[model samples]
Every structure is written in C-alpha cells, then in structure tokens.
Target: MSQIIDTSSRAHLLDLFLGLRPDTLSLWGKMEPQQMVEHLIDQVQYTNGKKIPFLEFSEEEAKLAKQKNIYTDLKIPKNVIFGTLPDQLIYPDLPSAIKQLMTELDDFDLYFRNPETTAIHGAFGPMNYKEWIIWHSKHFTHHLSQFGLIAMT
Candidate 1:
C-alpha cells in the first residue's frame, strides 16, 4: 500500500508546480493542453461536490492497479483517457475548479491532524491520506512532465 500526502508534503507538491508549463504535458498523454487542463479540472470537480460516475474497472484494470503500484505509476486506463483534445483551453474560464481543488487539498491537510481522518480511496479503494496525496501529486506531475511543463533542472 502507498502512503498518503500529509501537511508537510503539500509544500513539496506546490513547489513542483512552480515552473509547470502547459506544453510539457503533451509527451505523457495524447490529450492536448486544453484537454489536459480540462482533465485536471474534472479531477478537482470529483474531489469537490461534483460527483462523476466512478470509473468502472474491468478485471484487467483492477489487475493493473495492484497494491504496490502507485496510481501515478500506472498508465491511465483507455476508458477514461481522453479520446480527443478540445479546441480551446477550458480551465482558464473555470478558475473555480482550481480554487476548489486547492481548497479541498487545504482541507485535507488540516483534516489529517485528526488521525481519524485517514485517507480513504474514493472510488478506487483503500488508501491512506498520504497515499492519496502522493497519488494525486505524482499523477499530476507525471502528466505535467509529459507535456514538457516541468523538467528536471
């Protein structure tokens, strides 16, 4: 099982975002910049009140995401991966998405102080809060790295 991100690691994730560019994400996934942004926005929405249908997983999908493998380490399943890029950037107009995600993350960090609030996998499965954070951080970073937004300096 993977560890979840705690308050201490939030800063690290924020730091990772410092120099992110929209272009670098192209290399990691087929989605275009706008699609990538929209994808992330969807994630934020999921975390917030907007509930999308849980990603239905086939036997292969479940088998692929095993106990040891972090979510970021696994390839995005074909079912959910965007098929086509949008013509325009969607997130810029939806600043609330970013704000909501940040707010939820902040709440998550604060909630962690009460050990009872341990991370619980939403639709995926069991995972500590730290693991959830790491998964999200890594997942986002992986895409950002793919797009050429953030590079190892």
Candidate 2:
C-alpha cells in the first residue's frame, strides 16, 4: 500500500490534487471540486487531532471497527457519511481550498513525525501515527478517484 506519510507519496498525492480544475466532476460522490478539497483538509485535520469528530459509536461498534482494521483497508465502502463538516471549512473557491489543504498537509507531516501522538478516529477509534498514515492514503485515493485524479486498481 502506498503510504501518505512518505515525502514522495505526499508529493504524488499533491500533484493529483493540483491537477484538479474548477469544473472537475466527481465520478461517485456528491462533492464538488472545492468541497472535495475541503473534505480532504478535514480528513487531515481529523488525523492530526486538530478537529474532533462528531461520530459517537457504541463501545462494541468501536471495538468491531478496530478489529476489522477499517481505516487500514485499501478500499472503503462508497457513500459512507463521515459526519458533518464545519460550515466554516467551505472555501470560496477551489484554489483557496487547495491552498488550505496544502497547509493542512504540512501540518499533518509535522504531526506524523511525533510517534507519541495518536488520534481517535470516529469509526476506527484511537490510532497511532502509522495507522493514520495508512488511513489517509486510502482515504485520499478514494476521493482522488472520485475526481478522476487517479484510478483504483
């Protein structure tokens, strides 16, 4: 699996994100181009422990998700809702959203460097840096494919 925490992988992901134009259409999801960028930034923030999730799964559910290694999975189920995104995160344009996402990506990189830091995913429960990296890679790929930025094999 490609890991997003690696510099080269991050660069590749960034390239795909930058390749998106304002009119890029989603292949699956409902998100527009700017909304997709915002969504990705929110994903990064969730991983970095900068934003708390609204999801409150039952103890048993959390345990099951952890046991299943949900986030680490290469492909997530499509059309799964990720809770509500903050209204403030909605950017005025794709370029602005992309720029903010780039900043968040940098923040995620710094956060990942500290092995001690771990974030609790809403569905996946608490995750270490390695787990976060894996999740982000899969998550990014999923959305990138939605925008036709990459293809899933």
Top TM-score hit: 2
Candidate 1 residue lDDT tens string, 5-103? 232465665454444444433554467554555666555444433544353565456445634456444433323453465566645643443444456
CA-lDDT, candidates in order: 0.50, 0.72
Q: Can you write out model 2's per-residue Cα lDDT over 1-153, one digit (the tens) per residue?
A: 442323227676667878999898878767778877888887788866588764468767876876676444446666777676455547778878888888887887787787787778787677777777667777777777777777665
Cα shift from native, residue 109, model 2 (Å): 2.4
Model 1 misplacement above 4 A: 1-25, 48-55, 58-64, 71-90, 93-101, 107-123
Q: Residue 145's C-alpha lDDT in candidate 2? A: 73
Question: Model 2 — which ten-residue stretch has the worst lDDT?
Answer: 1-10
Clashing pairs in 2: none
| TM-score, structure 2 vs. true | 0.81
